[model samples]
Target chain A: MRNSIDTGAVICSVFAAVALFGAGSLLALMGYLVLKGLWPPMRALAALIFAHSGDSLLSIWIRSLFLLLAATLLALPLAIGTGIYLSEYTRQNRARELILSNIAGLGEMPPVVYGLVGWGALAPYFGEDRQTLVIVLTASVWLLPQLIVAAYWALQEIPVSFRRDSLALGATRWQTIRWTLMPYSGRLLAAKTLEGMARVGGEAAPVIMVAAAWPDSSKQPLHILPYYLYRSLIEAVDPATTRHFGAALLLVLTSVCFQWAALRLRRTGVVAGDTLPGLRKR
Target chain B: MRDSKLVVRNLSVYYGDFQALRSINLSIPLGAATAVIGSSGAGKSSLLRALCRMNELWDNVRTEGQVLLDGQEIYGPDVDVTEVRRRVSLIARHPYPFPKSIFDNVAYGPRLHGIKDKRKLDEIVKRSLKQAGLWNEVKDRLQESALNLSPGEKARLCIARSIAVEPEVLLIDDPTYHLDPVSAAKVEDVILELKQKYTLVFATNSMQQAGRVSDYVAFLSEGALVEFGPTSEVFARPKDRRTEDYITGRFS
Candidate 1:
């Protein structure tokens, strides 16, 4: 009160400022999206979202989930392993520096670029217009660098003392990483996998390039959400398309679900120097 | 010629061409507590590290000389540095506990040397922790993470870890620098008691610690071993003027 007016007033003002800032940005974007996009399509929502189109929405949701899950399985382990190898096994040298810089550069490459590369290289080798497997392959390569970078950063954030301590205890290099490094980095690795999932899920360009898009129920090679959305937008007659909005909502919900799981795992993962049960002295 | 358990002869260490330690020679008796007393940059820690072969872990760090354990050249061409380190373990100045449970920290050394029997591991862990004077404080929390220990407890845990493998020689580099006087005194007491089982060589900046724990004392200055004798003789009646100046705190 003596220094900066009343404490209560200051607290109230700070809360007011924070609330305004928090709600202002979201309100602005949601207001714009509703006014410009969702509202413009509102009259057709019931027919577009809820109407059962035989196997249309179901097929798209299944394909998208399948591709996302498959790619995650294929890429996640390799990416995490490479990340650990680089961060722990490979000390800083000219070659290690070169490899790390290459990873960063690969991560920055656009999705479209990856699409073209996959089309030119992988698609030809595996044959084009393939099923969900090719889509998985493309997604694996596209998300690998990002996952590796995230994991590498997570491992690097681990204090060097942790490793030194492990070694000092006569733990072998691999043992130290397994017993100490991996557990400590579990949260960040899980979070990175979630980020990679989102990247893989939303990828539209690569699937389109390698897996040809057909709107017909049986012919769409992988019929992932993005590919289906693009097909309904560009090829299918706009007003007559049956399941686009529902598919969109499903994709959004799936992303949200995966993100929630990631957050939960992050909360429970081993923290830096986390104490064991029944050990907290005070 | 003295019968010594550990012999360091003409040992020189360089970190990327900057000499960290010059030609140094000292002999440490078996099952005795020897302290290296010096100021910072006095090569006390380097000498201790060379004894355990831990200095080879660094890159662009070169050493010339012989560190002998029981009269066998430890750093010789055919010697396994890993095996040497396992036989002669070191505890650093600052306590760095692994990101693991306290039990795992103490069990690590035995596990490395292929001791997988859980019951044996348990006994070693308990014995080492007890010897480090940390058993009472952490017995109930053996499964707790080592990093969660207090600074003093962490230091003690490190000592326990080093001793778990039943190493023939224990090297402690500035073992109490990060500790308070009380905790430092406690660790010093542990070190004194530990010498009965293993040859103990420690580096300490505190002359009082050297006098208190060391059966033999070696005075090091500017990367050289200036004087070496029994602790009482070195402290009570100095042979070299520099040793007297250093011991009396007239100069470091």
Candidate 2:
């Protein structure tokens, strides 16, 4: 009661004020953008979603989505296998340590390098003018490390008792992995895969080299919003800025949705290293 | 002894340089319940794991022994681990129900063993649940995720899953350890019922549990089998001082 100004409360209030100030500035910026030329942005979004002069917005969106899907589907099995092998099978062996040490670096490698690898080695296998296929292959390879790390972490979190129980029930190692292990981490898998898909959605450098070659051709195998926005924002300054804003909005929305979904999934699913959320109250 | 379903001779287990179980001779009789009772680190769990060869999962774990199931060596070089586990199923202290429907958890074992027919799987699941005394409680919500079940029901579901595989032996590690009084009583009742058909080997630290559910009792102390005989005889008259000390609460 002697010194009624509680220092802790004052400090916390200051921090809260600072946070609100930062958020306020962000809101002001967004509000200004939304208020200025709001109609053009809206119309641009409509055009992107409904119809466009160069490509059907719906078709390109579909193609981009499917490219993400196809690349992930193609590469996931191998990545998941690596993850399971690392978490479930390998012990304090050298192989595990080596792979664990190198995986993050491999995963974070420049997307351009992956594109070159796809172009030089994989292109010959698929034949000429298969740029879309090359792009898909590059994206898949680029995503491999992230997928493996995420899935391996998820696999590691599952209680060892699950595997033991499965084995005790006379299930082989593969069967236990397929049935017991997979179901436990299914949500984590989906969350990570979605997050990966979102990351791929924003990448352009690797995709631009492969996709730009046939920009005017009839066989428009791939046309992603991010790449289109990049060109529109930089090259066509006057005509495409409004459409770029819409595309930018869509990109940010997709990224945020994936992140939100991942967070929610992690909250609900039984994760390793933390007490289960459902059981926390008890 | 000659009529035993599983025989262990001079069994010893070690994790790296640290030994967990000493040379132990044990015989689990056919169609009867056998309990290995001891203190916290008495190697009861290791004995159960040894029987099913589950200990091999641990790195640097060494086992020197002979575990015979139906006159076949379980720890033999050529014996497949999955096959050994199929014959000798293990139920752990804590329940681990897959995040699936109750029916799916029970059907997992049968399905893994190549029982693909839905009707046959349903029958096995139902029968196993009935045997584990959990059928009535989970009859309606067979489709719901097993994670929703209460702790006691989860334990029973694990039992149902194990027995669904139709194993010849069950190596249970303290089914009643963490359960409420009523749940423990139910589990004990299920054990009594199960002993009539399949051999049961319980790894429990509770002396009272061994007396209640087991026909024969093996008193283990500090990883060594101190006394092994009929439950009535051992509880009435323990031959070894260590076993008597344990039973009389002299010192665990």
Candidate 3:
């Protein structure tokens, strides 16, 4: 017993040290980025906004925001519908297994491949002038599988007891889904949505391929933050280094904010005693 | 069994290739508590779920049987499943109060059946809670989320929710499975009181609880009925060796 206790204490100390080290590393990285990169770009953006100058950087950031929103709007319904169909409507059969495996495979594929598909197959049909449209389409497609998977897992996380209870109360299957399953899974679904948005927003490769394919077009190229950051890094001279860091800081901040919101929503749901896991506490 | 509320004839349940319950027959007496006592995986839950056709909700679960509710074939093709469920309500092992107000949880069933009058709904909610012996505890906080209630109160709330639909037969599957002893006793009191108005069939693992709460006790082992009779008689003189051994604490 003495040896076991000593071993256990040593294990706990090691785990504690590991956790503190990981947390310290993350905090240091964030602090470095904020100090080195955040201030200059923030001041420049503020100045441009105050002067009413259409700075190319501000416009690119705005375009990036618009693309993110557009992709989210386009993908949300399709993902939710497909998720509901897969989880609620489908039986445990070969067809469902096939569809799920294929979706898993699609989720694992890189975003650049989607960009290539847009550039090669879709650009000729829609022409090079529709850069925003083509990019949104490809980005939305890339976002679909991940969002659907998130939605599916969120819905699945709800306890089966809820479904059984609702149906036992004379609720029809659709009524059970609407009244019980959907409401209970709402917070989880919203959190997944925000996380998906962050992921798609930070994706630079798809936007790059589509945008670069039409550099010589007469239309003004769509300017997004990820693409601009990529260009700044690739062409990094003495002056461009700070710009690259600034872009990285902004992207990281956006993703962190989204993740923070998701965490807050999930935590509030648990604390408010709205979930089954919370209900088990008593 | 002359005035049976429900009659099960040759009931069997299967989950894909595995059989959960073999062909079994039993009669549930009207306006009395019948306890189906067994160890885990002895098909007690399957039998309860099959009575209300709740087993059909799960994937790969198939039931072959005839459950007669007041002599009407419940599994008949022409029957409306929702009506059957409403008539024969079930309270699961765990209390699953909707993430809604206490009043709303009780009113959910009535609203589903198209009870729109606010006064009528209020009356039903109050009456059901009172019937479940929970009105005094939660009357002041009708709008509070049901999830905020204690485990015992939540169990009673579930009972209230079921009775709000005014089901003829109340099938409770181990209502005290997750409760402390004090809470379990309170639930047992509610069950004893409820049997006066509705036909009660419950599944439990405790022989003591079965003796305390049920008028009739059916002992199940390995998906088959070992012995069944009045609670006193079964406890006093178990006919089967398996039933005798189980009651005497030989094996769970």
Candidate 4:
């Protein structure tokens, strides 16, 4: 008993230390970014928000939001459909395993490869006039594999008994997926989608290959936060450092908001009796 | 038997390379409670699942041989799998109330078969819940989430849900495995009552429960049927040494 108690205490202390370290690092980073980044760009951000005219930080932030929404809208249905097909309809076979392995491989491929594909392959068909469309398509392609994997895992996380019970009640496979599996995994799917949106909001490489660096007389203006930050850093000037920091701050804020929304959704689902009664007590 | 509701011939079940149930033949009587009793991993649940084709839901699960319901082969190519399931439903040991209201949980089966009239659904739900002996406790809270019910209530609610579709056979796989003694007794009572109407095939680990609730008992040991006969005769006579030992508490 004494040895077990000591071991338990040691495990608890180790976990506590890890938790403290993570929280401390996040706080330190946020404090530094707020002091250095938010302060320098406060006036310009305010002006951009109010005027909505030029390619300023806030304008780029809004544009990033738009791109994130558009790309997510394009990718979500296809990813969910593919996920459902893989998880529910297919039996365990060599072909299914091969397809899943390929999807996993695609998820790990660099975003720059997707950007290169968009530039070399799709640009000619779309022509120079539809650069924004190409950029949106490239971003959606990058986001698709990740979202598909997310959706598959989310559906997998539902208890097998739900499917069994539904089927035992004479529900068709489609009805089971529609009524039980979808509702039970809805919050998880939404959380994953939000996390994906956070990632796409801050992605720079794919956008750069498809979008022009700066707004020129000949080029269409396509300002997003990540591209703005990339440009600011590459300039390598003192003011550019502050601008990049500000952009970094905005990206971090967007990610934090997405994470917060995900957490809030999970909590709200539990409170609203989305979880099983047996699990709710725990 | 001429009165048999379901006939199983050379039934074998395999999960990957592991065979859970060996080739076994049995006949379940109509409008009577037949108990499949065995110890853990003794293929009782497999037999129940196989009766209604529920075993096919799992991946890598291969079921062989024939299961006939009312002289019709359920595994035949022309048979509608969904129709078979609707005709013969399995009530799992654990209750899984969908994340829906009590009314919806019971109405789920009827609705799946395309019953859209609200009045008809309401009547079915009421009758089913009443038949399961859960109507008095839950009638006021029919709109409440089924998850909020106690363990015993949830078990009965699952029974209610299963019967709402009015299936011919009710294959209950250890309905009281997770319930307390009082709750277990209550579920046993519901099972006893249900046998008067539906052809009930119950799988259990308890010999006493088998004696209490079943008219005919099929004793299984290690994926094979050891003995099967009327419960009173099987309890008294030693047709097989293993069945005699099991009923006498010499071994599980």
Residue-by-residue lDDT tens digits, candidate 3, B78-189:
9999999999999988767877899999999999888999999999999999999999999999999898899999999999999999999999999898899999999999
Name the better of 1 and 4 by TM-score: 4
Residue-level lDDT of model 1, residues B206-232, one tens digit each, is 988899898899988888889999999
Q: Worst ten-residue run, lDDT, model 1 chain A?
A: A273-282
In model 2, where do residues sit more than 4 Å from their true spots? Answer: A1-37, A40-52, A55-63, A92-94, A110-128, A205-223, A236-240, A267-282
Question: How many clashes does the backbone of model 2 have?
Answer: 0
Fnat, 2 decimals, each candidate: 0.29, 0.82, 0.78, 0.76
Q: Please estimate how well model 2 matches the true structure, expressed as its whole-model Cα lDDT.
A: 0.81
Query: DockQ, per-model, please?
Result: 0.35, 0.67, 0.65, 0.65
Off by over 4 Å in 3: A1-45, A48-55, A93-98, A218-221, A232-245, A270-282, B232-252
lDDT per residue (tens digit) for residues A156-264 in model 4: 7676777888899898999999988888778888988898788777778876776542234245335688877887787676654466777787888888899899877
lDDT, candidate 3, A129-154, per-residue tens: 67778878887888888888877876
* lDDT value, candidate 4, whole model: 0.84
lDDT per residue as tens, model 2, B1-252: 438999999999999888999999888899889998999888999989899998887877899989889888888888888988988999977757877789999998999999999999989999999999999998999999888888888888999999999999998998887789898889889999999989999888787888888999998878999999999999999999888889888992
Weakest ten-residue segment in model 1 chain B by summed lDDT: B52-61
- Which residue pairs show collisions in model 3? none
Roughly what TM-score does model 3 have, to 2 decimal places? Answer: 0.88
